[model samples]
Structure formats: C-alpha cells, structure tokens
Target: MAKITYIEFTGEEHVLDLEIGTSIMQGAVDNSVQGITADCGGACSCATCHVYVEPEWLNKLGDKSEMEEILLEEVCQPQANSRLSCQLKVSADLDGMIVRLPESQF
Candidate 1:
C-alpha cells in the first residue's frame, strides 16, 4: 500500500494508506475525504476529482491522457501540476505523495 496525503483548499489534510492499483480518487471517496466529489466515479469523464499533485511528486505520476487533459482544461484553477485523481493509480512509488485540492471542483 501507498500512503497518500490529500490537502483541501482550506488546508485540511486527509492521509490514507491506499492499496496498490487504487486510484487517488477512490481513496478519497471511500474515506469520505471532503474535497473530491468524484461525480463520475473513476471514469475520467468528469473533473470533480481534479487535484494539484505536489511539485516534488509530479515526476512520479504518469502523463495525463488526452481525455484527462481535456477534462482538466475545464476544471477550476488548472495548474501546471493539475491532474485528475482518477487517472493516478497507487503504487509503492507513490508513498507519501501529496496532492492539493482546488478551491472548487465545479
């Protein structure tokens, strides 16, 4: 399992030990973390699970897919580090990874 930290816009933090292969979005939704809405689940069809991966961890994640890139373009506060949580799968390499939620998902 990988330990991931999700920080809300308000500075609230939720740290979870997610099993390998689980998406970051799944960890938040399953644990009732407040920032990620995940309206479309892990389908990558919605931007509700948008997050900003901490700069130090950016190189550890995979490149965003075409669908993810398009969806991110429509989310609030898109940044160079912006990512769709559902597009990120957990793994040993991601242990201690930190992601910051946007002020709004809509």
Candidate 2:
C-alpha cells in the first residue's frame, strides 16, 4: 500500500492509504476526497481529475504520456506540476505522494 495526500485549494487535506496498482483518481474517489471529479473514470478522456503534484514528489511519479500532455493543456489554470490524477498509478515507490487541487476543479 501507498499513502497519498490530496490537498485542496482551500487547504483541506485528504490523506489516504491505498493499494498499489490503483489510480490516484480511484483513491480519491474511494475516499471521497473533494475536487477530484474523475468524470472519465480513469479513461484519460476528461481533465476533471486534474491536480498539481508537489514538487518534491514529481520525480517519484511516472512521466506524462503524449496524450496526457495534450489533455493537460485543456485544463483550467494549468501549472508546471499539473497532471491528470487518473493517469497516476499508485506504487510502493510513490508512498507519501502529495498532490494539490486547483480552485477551478473544486
């Protein structure tokens, strides 16, 4: 299992202990973490699961694919750390990952 932290724009934090191989979007939805709408259900079609990965944890996560990069461009208030939560798979190596939600998503 891996522990992930999801912090909202208003500073609300949802700390979750989730199984490996699950998407970050699933973790948030399973735990009822606010702001991760995940309208595409991990299909990578919608950008509603958008989040900003904490700078320190960026390297621990996987690199964005060509399609993810293109999808991210369509989200609101994109940032250098912005990513689609559904694209992030949980792994033992990603324990303690932290992500921030954009105001527009909440």
- Cα deviation at 69, candidate 2, in Å, is 0.7
Q: Give stretches of model 1 more than 4 Å off.
A: none
- Scored by lDDT, model 2 comes in at 0.91
Q: Cα-based RMSD of the predictions, in order?
A: 0.6, 1.2
Q: Which stretches of candidate 2 lie over 4 Å from their true place?
A: none
Model 2: per-residue Cα lDDT over 40-99, one tens digit each: 799988889999998988888878998899999999999999999999999998899999
TM-score of 1: 0.98
Whole-model Cα lDDT of every candidate shown, in order: 0.95, 0.91
Best by the lDDT measure: 1
Alpha-carbon deviation at 99 in model 2, angstroms: 0.5
Give per-residue CA lDDT, model 1, range 73-106, as digits (tens): 9998899999999999999999999999999999
In candidate 2, how many Å is residue 63 off? 1.6
Task: Report the number of clashing residue pairs per model.
Answer: 0, 0
